[model samples]
Target: MKKIVFLFAFGLAALFAQAQSPAKIGFADVEYIFSQMPEAKQIETELQTLQTQLKKQYDGKVAEFQKKLQEYQAYGNTVPDAVRQNTERELQQLQQNIQKLEQDSQENLQRKQVQLMEPVYTKVGKAIEEVAKANAFTMILTNQVSGLDVVLYADDQSDISDLVLKKMGITPQAATTNPPKK
Candidate 1:
């Protein structure tokens, strides 16, 4: 019984030792990858076009609102009490409508961006996965410069941004800059 218990403990230790492979960490800057992707440029152009259209509509509404406000200011005293109140209500409604439209435009732009970016995000994500697996990276971290940077002190040698871009068939520029470790 004692011999069997010892053997069982030894087998568990061996299994644990086999499971404890060293973690090979790698980081990729996805934003850099997106900047190198042509799809991202097209998406930006589409978003800008949508924004211009929304801006035109918004400007038209503002012009209409301003004309109404000016007319109210010019003729308000001469107008009858009921007429004045009605004009005031119309002006208030126009202001509210303008605010609502502005909010809606912002939301529409955000939605469009997400809609356009979803596929690109997926494509880049898959490429990252492939690169990580092919290179035997146990973990991959996002090295976003603008947002929450998860990596604090990664050596540029460990950067997989160029690898990811290459995996996606994008030849990385010779001048791609990787920030030095902090």
Candidate 2:
């Protein structure tokens, strides 16, 4: 009788353990998905054009500053003290302006990129959520930049990137192989 009771308790414990299985996990390469989107190409082109324009403006200012500096150096010894001092001050101001413009250009470019990509990111996020729910995934991870794998090991079958693209109305591409375990 005691043996039978022990066996029953052991069976119940096994059943409970089986019922509490780990949640299903999946991963997606969001950067890959963004690259696949047509809107991303447009954004890239727009950003490139803006960057080129900014570069030209910056170059013009730099050239102007260089010319002024050259002029000052050529005439510094001949010029009166007051004139040399004024030219030096003007050159310093120009240099500061160039630095300010460079900083502003960088900040502007970053702001524009975020503005342009915000909508696409929102759309992709929605698709990921939909795919996760439809496929019963408990959590979804994203691959890091420069091929840095945030997830060391996930089964190949657990990649839901294709499904997410499909949900976003884009055709699914072949899945890349999972990163090797650390």
Candidate 3:
């Protein structure tokens, strides 16, 4: 009958649709993985040392500038016009040097951080890829809790962060309870 045929067709369509749906989606927190890495602590220590050294140098420059500024303020009015103008030029140059040094230090710190973290990031990325391929994950989303939320909602079972860590030969901590489901 026409009704039977139509019902059969509809059932076949539904089954096909279900077959075509994505198999799995996973979430990972790369920052969390980095926090667990031993090398990360070492990198932090190195960066801190560099920062401290830079700060000391910066402080010395600042002290020098302050000393010069004080001298100018105290003796500026008593000095000859040409001497005052030359001191002003020197002060301006010192200020410019201080600003340049601060900028360079910041840039150097950033560069060093990237250089140190690059290998760790690559290792984590490869582990994530391996886990995704082995588990047949259709997509693996980063779940970093920066200012913006990367993932709105994911089932606890769909988190692949532990698996990636395990792939990297790191034992994961006990799983935490999932957030309340909506």
- Against the reference, the lDDT scores of all candidates come to 0.90, 0.88, 0.85
lDDT of 3: 0.85
Lowest-sum lDDT 10-residue window in model 2: 173-182
Model 1 residue 74 lDDT score? 97
Report the lDDT of model 3 for residue 144.
Answer: 52
- Sorted by lDDT, highest first, which candidate order results? 1, 2, 3
Superior candidate under lDDT, 1 versus 2:
1
Selected candidate, larger lDDT, 2 vs 3: 2
For model 3, state the Cα shift of residue 33 in Å. Answer: 0.9
Candidate rank order under TM-score: 1, 2, 3
lDDT, candidate 2, 42-108, per-residue tens: 9999999999999999999999999999999899689999999999999999999999999999999
Q: Which candidate has the top score in TM-score?
A: 1
User: For each candidate, what TM-score against the reference?
Assistant: 0.88, 0.83, 0.82
- RMSD (Cα, Å) for all candidates, in order, is 2.8, 5.3, 5.3
- TM for candidate 3 is 0.82
